[model samples]
Target: MRTVRLPGLERPVGAIGFGCASLGSRISAAQGLDALADAHAAGVNWFDVAPAYGAGDAEAILGRFARGKRDGIYICTKVGLAPPQRNALLKQVYSMARPIVGTLTGLRRAFRRMPSTRNVSLPLTPQLITDSLHSSLQRLGTDHVDVFALHKPAHGDIGRDDIQRALQGLRQAGKVRLIGVAGDLEAAQIALANRDTYTMVQLADDPSAQPLQQLPPAGGPCYAVVTHSILGVGGTRERVLHALRMAGPAAMSEMIRLGYSPKPEQAVAELLLDRALAANANGVVLMSMFGARHRSENLRRVQGTPKPEALQWVSRLLAPVSESRE
Candidate 1:
């Protein structure tokens, strides 16, 4: 429930944001709404969703949850992508597959990163930005969203005046409170480089990559940052474990003494998550906490103290290997 005074924000944004990428896809409406309510009850005021999320049903469910509470919460939804239209049979197939995928990690990982066949990114144009925002507004049941973002945009798109001007117009027209770029590290850097045109940047925070090192620390940059993929995504979990195993018993013992779990995977997960929270102390770190367990655990982590030693461990592990002595 801890909050930060992010520049350009009317309200203090929660340190941990609720990620709704699986709202209506892996989770049912009833469950998604309940999760949203639980998060909101726990003082989570930031929600991150997209047009392509939850097979395009997340925004509507979130809109429903936001009824009478829109002013109390901050919403960031993205453009440039839409869900693929699924017929009744395919929808049923997805529903039946959810439980199986939940139990099988391999099946989940296979489809986790695979782009949907029909869900596609649209060409970024002024018309597309305006039209997309209009549709999103209708779905969100809000006239103006807290943040409007370009979904995984290309570098060229970021440089286009037509697109930036379109976003600026949205702000001028009172449709979007702020504009941002949400993509890989490159996309975030691109947006950060053009801070004049972008107000926020959303990207993954990998422990091994330590991409956040490239940016000025929290409260230093004018633009707000929203980081995601703190756990397991993009093989970060494995990389953390790899680093620990290679670092040998002394590092592991230190981690254990520092209150990390002895089990390597869990220890690595905790260290990485703690480091992310510490790194983005003044920013928002997105957590896909659809389940009750994840919600409680992550909220606890958000409220917990930052572990600077954890940050140092990850940075050392991920830092480039020095070349052999001449």
Candidate 2:
């Protein structure tokens, strides 16, 4: 496993991390535990989890796996916008509201970039930040976590300053070793510039995100990079198929004709092993590995393959998209 030494945290973490988001919701407790074991045995030392992920069950399951061997792992957890309380009617309403709200918001944004359509932002107040961390610590069954990150904020939310300050306090209090942001492209660039305030930024590390290649190296306090969605949400195969079908048959055919091979999603992940090593990411967190048989194949790809030359050649083939977009 490749490793990057984060400055503020003073820990060298694996280049590939396991994200335990679907722990208790989709995968059974036994399955989740087994997956965690496999990841650990495979040299994945960094584990990322959040309360919003499986109605708090994800973190609970992670807590169980992290109990006896906390020292050997680097855990990162997030706070804000928790799962709705257990009220059947409320849960039903929430389930319905989520997709509707998202679709409507997308349509509204497409129609007009109106300020009125912005989402309500929650502030990371001193008490809220402190209390949330304490709760996460309890659930994680650990005293001090290696990194504490903030989830993506809603529109019009200016929570960065407050969240950074809260993270600083946590570092001072020895509750959190480093402060980071898990957000979109723009937010991550902003956080990267604010290295004195935030220690790391976690974001998508897809080929489309080539601009980040120019980010200044961790010169000062060493801003670590933790990437997720590197395989694209549903993994490469499914995501490319969707993009092609939705974008058009002509585009898909052009992509194929240009020498973009249709490798299984796992083969796509094999490409990332080298890229993660090259990018110096502290870790690349993947979602569940047992949700689909393809995912297990992906895990095997990450473990068995070393395809540096293939990735370089593919990057050359796709250079048009990478360069023209820039």
Candidate 3:
């Protein structure tokens, strides 16, 4: 695997980082650990996890797996957004409903329909940031994380002095090495503007969704530009499928005429990975792979050379579809 050095980090991390968003929720502990092991064996040293993922179970699983190799790995966990605290019964129902929704979504995809989803939001208050970081540390069994990020905060939240000070305190206390902002374009822009406070920024990147042109230039305090959603999650897949459906009987002919394959998922993955690599060539691209096959495939794609001609063709073919969704 190819590796790159971020400004604040001492060690070089793999170009493709592992994302643990689906851990303990969509996959079992054994599977998650095995995937992590596979990734490590493949030379992936960076891992990203959020407190809200798996309702606080992903961190514990990652912690258990990081026991022997904690020093070698670059772990990043978010602080702002966390699982629901109240509504125990409702939370349980939601938890149960997730897998059911995922299964149904898979079935729907088999029939060329999109699955609806919802996101749970949390306040990015100073107290919440401190409390969440402490809890994440406890769960990970680590004294400090390489990077601690604000998990999808609003643009206005980044302007708060208390939040910045809290993160500064954590760094001063040796609890976190770097502070980062992760989420949408607004949060990323806020981080770029306050480069003195935030050193890293994680945002979504894909071929059909938010392209690289939309992001701020990387430099100054914002040395690390970590990207995710390369697999076209969050409606990208649905959008692509919907576009193909709209093409009707001419979809296959159009793909062939454009010098691309007719397999939508493969095409999407290839295009997204190519775009992500090109966009963040000097940084890290985060991806989630639950099974061995997927882990290997993604590793190969990231490590392999980019196909510029194919990428250009695919980009041109998908431009109209991408623009229509905007």
Candidate 4:
């Protein structure tokens, strides 16, 4: 596995980290544990989880899998967005409905450039941050996380001294090794600006939505810029197919120098991972994988050479189409 050294970390971590959001929600506990073991065996040392993921089951499953192997791994979990306290029956119901809600949320964002029109008001106080991290550590069966992040926080939340102090307390107490802020572009900028407070930032990095473009040329003390959502899976395949039809195979081969795969989704995934690696040169790129095969494929693609000029050409070609609707 490829690795990058983040500031304050004792050692470098795998460039391609495992995100455990699908555990116990999309995949069975056994499958999740098996895949995790496979990843660890294959040299993937970074694991990202949150209380909000699988309604906290992902963390528990990861905890169970990580029990004996904690010494060799780097675990990252988020705070500020705790799952609702629901009964066992309700939790099961939510587990079933989570995918549907996610699909609808994606659709809404695709059309509106925003997630869920409904209001989700979470208090981002210092106490909340402190409390959330405590709960997250308990769920993950770890006394301290390598990195503790504020999940999808607002810009205002990142500027608060109380929140910063709370995170500092965690670090001082050895409950967290590094402080991180995870969210969209705005939140990232806020975190970057407050370098004294946060040492890491995690954000989505999709083809259509490149948050890297918004980052300052000289970032502050942030050592790790972790990125996720590399696979823009849903409508991306159709878009890529349409582009292939219009550009033809010859143009694509000449431009990208990479031959097209029979599976367009696999091709797209490769391109996305390449672009992500190129964009975040000094940071880790997190991808969610259910099985070993998928994880291996992703690791291979990320290790491959990327044609940034070719990707730039494609982006320029599609720029007009993107602007037309606006």
Candidate 5:
């Protein structure tokens, strides 16, 4: 993977980042550390973690694993509600609900526990952003973060000059090399367009999902771009092939039946890489390559065969659909 530059960041990061969301949640701490070590050894420089993941265990584990290698990595973390402390009741509630009910009720529970005012937080705000940075630094045992993002803000939270001011202050203090916002791209675009506060932007540019219009380059010096969920997590190959089958794409069906199989893992990855390149993205945050077997598979997919010349094909496939909507 090639490294790309972000204007204010002290170091260029690898094209593929390691997302730590699943590390402490679905995996054990020692195993997560092993995965981190594997990623680091494989030349992956970007690491993305969030407070909302694993109730702070993921960051703690990453900090332990990254102890002496601070300068060699680009550590990116988010500020948001920390994952709730797990309880038997909450576990039982989650297990007994239908999928939709589970989602809605879980969200409601989370919202209920969130601070009513944005200013009141996990550590309370004497300095707000600075306090959060110090807390993250202490946990990660680092002097500075390469990129720090406000994970996701409330709907009416826009135009909050206080938040903007706090982020700018972080940059000046050298606590964070760059500032960014993460969530839906539309909100990110609105933030970047309306304010010059952020140096880089992170968003998904995967093809399978409804195409999101890319924000035109911000010009001048800027962090290239970092994105996640580019593989369209839920848009697996089986789902896509099924859709194509239903639509009766005779050529595609023939290709499928003849064992001209486009491996789901490879095809989806290719689609992600293709779209990111199209969007002029510098790097992406990729997660879930934990086990040694999984790691080997990912490395093979990422580094094995030559990348196809896919831009032209994807453009032709998508142009008519986009044009029809316009």
Candidate 6:
């Protein structure tokens, strides 16, 4: 429910942004639209989508949700990586599997690994940049998007003069209000270096790495850092909990009381989210919002995120023996 300032946009963005990567794919339109509406109603104004997202249908569903309310929300969609191309059999299987996997989420990973579900998108080009925005605008049912980003670009793509020009032209034309890079740490670092073209950078918010800490302090640079992949690392929660146990009862109790999660796993996750937001206090954190429970949980987490003491507690708990002693 908290808000952060994002340069190049007239409105301040919500701290928690809804990610539409599963909109039309894992979630049906009926539930997806309702979920999006719920998020918007809960003060989550930022929605991240891509042409490749939601089996290439997320933008349309989001568009349906944003109708008439366009001015109130911020949309960030990306180029590069189009949707997966599937045959009729796969499509039928996907349709049938959606409900099953939704209930049995553990199976989602297995489904994702099934062959030929997604298509490998073409490499970035100036024309693809121009063409993609037009298509995305159409799908999103908006005249312009708040942020248009390159999806997982190669190391060299960020500084390419032609690619830079393409993004700039879109901004100048009002097709996109801001240009950004959405990828890993390396890509984000490159975007930071090429601030002339990139005003935003989206990357994973890993606790071990704390990548978003690279952003300049408040009022120093106008760059908006959007972080995702928080708590996505395998076994991170267990690892943190183990370390906390090693630190003794005080550390565990402090984290649980501060996080306010009924379950230890949820509490640890909330603590991690707090650390990520603290690492980039002025930026947005993206989370997939399809299920009502998880959506509500994430919305609640943002209000308490960037909790400095919680971050400090987790850092000390997870610190190495030598460093923590120091």
Q: What range of 10 consecutive residues in model 5 has the weakest lDDT sum?
A: 117-126
Overall lDDT per candidate, in order of appearance: 0.83, 0.62, 0.76, 0.74, 0.61, 0.82
Q: lDDT at 183 for candidate 1?
A: 89
For each predicted model, how many residue pairs clash, with residues at least 3 apart or on different chains? 0, 0, 0, 0, 1, 2
lDDT of 3 by residue, 1-326 (tens): 77788998888889999999867655667778988998899899999998877555789999998998999999999977655454354345445655564457565354223221223578777788888889999999999999999988888988689889988999999999999989887788888788777988899876665555666676444468899887676576566656655656576576557544467766556556766777678889998877676687778877764445545544545668666445
What is the alpha-carbon RMSD of candidate 2 to the true structure? 7.1
Looking at model 3, which ten-residue stretch has the lowest summed lDDT? 110-119
> TM-scores for all candidates?
0.90, 0.72, 0.82, 0.84, 0.74, 0.92
Clashing pairs in 2: none
Better of 1 and 3 by lDDT: 1
Off by over 4 Å in 3: 85-104, 107-120, 209-211, 233-235, 238-264, 305-311, 321-326
lDDT of residue 186 for candidate 3: 76
Give the root-mean-square deviation of each candidate in angstroms. 2.8, 7.1, 4.7, 4.5, 6.3, 2.2
Q: In TM-score terms, which candidate is top?
A: 6
What lDDT is obtained when candidate 1 is compared to the true structure? 0.83
Candidate 6 — what's its lDDT? 0.82
Please give the lDDT score for candidate 4.
Answer: 0.74
Residues 172-281, candidate 5: write the lDDT tens digits: 88888878776677757756664567766667655554334566565664444667665554444335434444434563554445333355434434444554454444
Q: lDDT winner between 1 and 4, please give it.
A: 1
Q: What lDDT is obtained when candidate 5 is compared to the true structure?
A: 0.61
What digit string (tens of lDDT, one per residue) describes model 1 on residues 1-326? Answer: 67886777887888999999888877888889999999999999999999988878889999999999999999999999878655344356567887886567788777665655246778899999999999999999999998999998877899788888889999999998889999888888778777767879898887767688787544445888889888746676886688778878998999889887798887877777788889887789999888887788778877766667767777776655562111
Clashes of 3: 0
